[model samples]
Target: MFSSALSVLALASLCAGVLAQTYTIFFDNKCGRGTPTLVDQNGAVLSTGGAYNFNGSIIGASAFLQTGSCGPSGENCCTLKINDDGAGPECTKSVGTNNCPAEKCSASGGNLVIIFCD
Candidate 1:
């Protein structure tokens, strides 16, 4: 009986993990230079926050940052704060402009595509 109960408990844990979801912000450098920062609905930096890796010259660099959130779908749209890295403020759409579309920040697949538009 104890063994059976233990097995059930383990199964439940596994299922929970499988149901867990995460989100990734796809940053674009269409304009010039900028980085996307993830913030919660309350205007706070997400607990699990990090920057994306940039490649090529600074003029045309591009990358994406990722953040993890186990919250519900509708309650998980993060505020993508766009910061134009000295390339003219508001030249991007991910940070300065609060117009980046929100999508399910999925664990398996990436959500929302952000870009720096000049």
Candidate 2:
């Protein structure tokens, strides 16, 4: 009975790890300037690093390089938003980020790359 219980506990822990969800953020600051910023739904700062790792699903997140023109949450600028909920980048060639049209990315696939001036 004790052996059976131990085995069950071990299996449960392994399953928990396997079922965990995670994502990664990579900052490709090809512009060679400014700090990278990431913020949550409520405009809370998450990271200002080369990369960030997230656990579980992200919601209403935004990321951009702080070139002194954008907000802490990458707000107050163009609609170049990014989301964990499978949205894509804002703006088309005709619309332009300078006058963004609204869009974003995904978190389920587990990778988010934020580029600057490239």
Candidate 3:
């Protein structure tokens, strides 16, 4: 009985780990004097370097390349944006009064690389 219970526990642990999703954000800054930053909606800094790693999915998060008036978590910037919603991750572009339709992500899960000035 004890051996059976231990086997069950071990199986549960393995299943839990398998169910958990992992995500990595890589910032490729191909420009001058720019720092990459990722942030959430509640004004929390995720990463401020070349790469960031976390478990599970992210929603309403923002990424910014340190430059004029770009706030932490990527607020107040005129550029392309990506966010993961219920459907999936999306790529959006906002310019003036004309905003383009968001592009959906087909990626299952893995590393996300954001390149700046490239």
Candidate 4:
């Protein structure tokens, strides 16, 4: 009975791990000569470039962007929402003079690309 219980526990643990989902946020800063900031939904600066991966559970969580070498108080920041539907890999300038368009998320993918600038 002990052996069987251990097996069940192990299976449960494995299942939990398998059920957990992770999503990646790809940041493309093409603003020419400025460093971009990526902020999480809780107003935390998660990263400043390239990419960031987060737990898939934060479905509606958003990441805000600050372009240029504006440090933390920069202007022209944009917002990108976290989605796990694999629908996007899109771009949108939430708040900026930059002319980037909003892209839709993919339906079966976990990769989202946010483009700043061109």
Please name the candidate that would achieve the greatest lDDT relative to the true structure: 3
Error of 3 at 50 (Å): 2.8
Candidate 4 lDDT over residue span 1-118, tens digit each: 9999999999999998887666677766655544545654555677777677765344444544443434353334445555444333333324543533342333237566665554
lDDT for each of the candidates?
Answer: 0.37, 0.60, 0.61, 0.54
List where candidate 2 sits over 4 angstroms from the true fold: 1-3, 85-109
Q: Tell me the TM-score of model 2.
A: 0.67
Candidate 1, backbone clash total: 5
| C-alpha TM-scores of all predictions | 0.42, 0.67, 0.70, 0.64
| Displacement of the residue 33 alpha carbon in candidate 3, Å | 2.1
Better candidate by lDDT, 2 or 4: 2
lDDT per residue for candidate 1 within 49-117, as digits (tens), equals 244322211222222233333122112423433333333212132344233344222112223345434
**Residue 89, model 3: Cα distance from true site in angstroms:** 5.2
Please write out the lDDT profile of model 2 over residues 10-73, one tens digit for every residue. 9999999988766687766666666767777788887885677766666666666676887666
Model 3: what TM-score? 0.70
Model 1 residue 62 CA deviation (Å) reads 20
Off by over 4 Å in 3: 85-90, 97-109
Show where candidate 4 strays beyond 4 Å: 59-65, 68-76, 83-108
**How many Å off is the CA of 98 in candidate 2?**
2.6
Off by over 4 Å in 1: 47-110
